[model samples]
Target: MSLALDIFTVVMVVAGLFFFYAGSIGMLRFPTVESRLHALTKADNLSVGFIALGVMPQMAEATDALKLLLAWALILFSSAAASQLIAIAARRNRRRDP
Candidate 1:
């Protein structure tokens, strides 16, 4: 069972890595700030969550897993707020431009 869990963790980590790469490429290739922020926040949040999940099974104690999850949740919330702020600012800039 533990071996299976380890394999699952590996797969999840690899998937998260792919998303991380995609986010980077998206930020570089996307033409608009909103699109880039969308790409950045969505992919990054998933990447961190997946990484935390991957590490959860390996933790020695239940509290460690809980801590990891809490950290991911906090990051998710903060990133969402930050994305909203960035989008609002971008929209304001667009409105100001002729």
Candidate 2:
């Protein structure tokens, strides 16, 4: 059982890291602001989820796990809001420039 949990945690952490790397690549390679934003937000959100899930199982107490979940939720909400705002601004700027 312990070994299984450890393996699960490792797998999830690796998955999270992969997403992070993918997101960075997308950010650098994407042609447009909107596309880059889309890729970054999607990948980052998934990475955060995977990392949280990976860490939750290793937590010693229920409260600690709950706290981690709460933190994850906050990150999701904040990132979504920020992405929306950034997209809106980019749209406005594009309109003004052209």
Q: For each candidate, what is the lDDT?
A: 0.94, 0.94
lDDT of 1 at 75: 99
Residue-level lDDT of model 1, residues 1-98, one tens digit each, is: 99999998998899889899999999999999999998999999999989899989999999999999999999999999999999998899899993
* Model 2 spans > 4 angstroms off: none
Query: TM-scores for all candidates?
Result: 0.93, 0.97
Candidate 1 versus the native: TM-score? 0.93
- Please list the Cα RMSD from the true structure of every candidate, rounded to 1 decimal place: 1.0, 0.7
Looking at model 2, residue 23 earns an lDDT score of 96
After superposing candidate 1 on the true structure, give the runs of residues whose Cα lies further than 4 Å from its correct spot: none
Per-residue lDDT of model 2, residues 33-94, tens digit only? 98999889999999999999998989999899999999989999999999999999999999
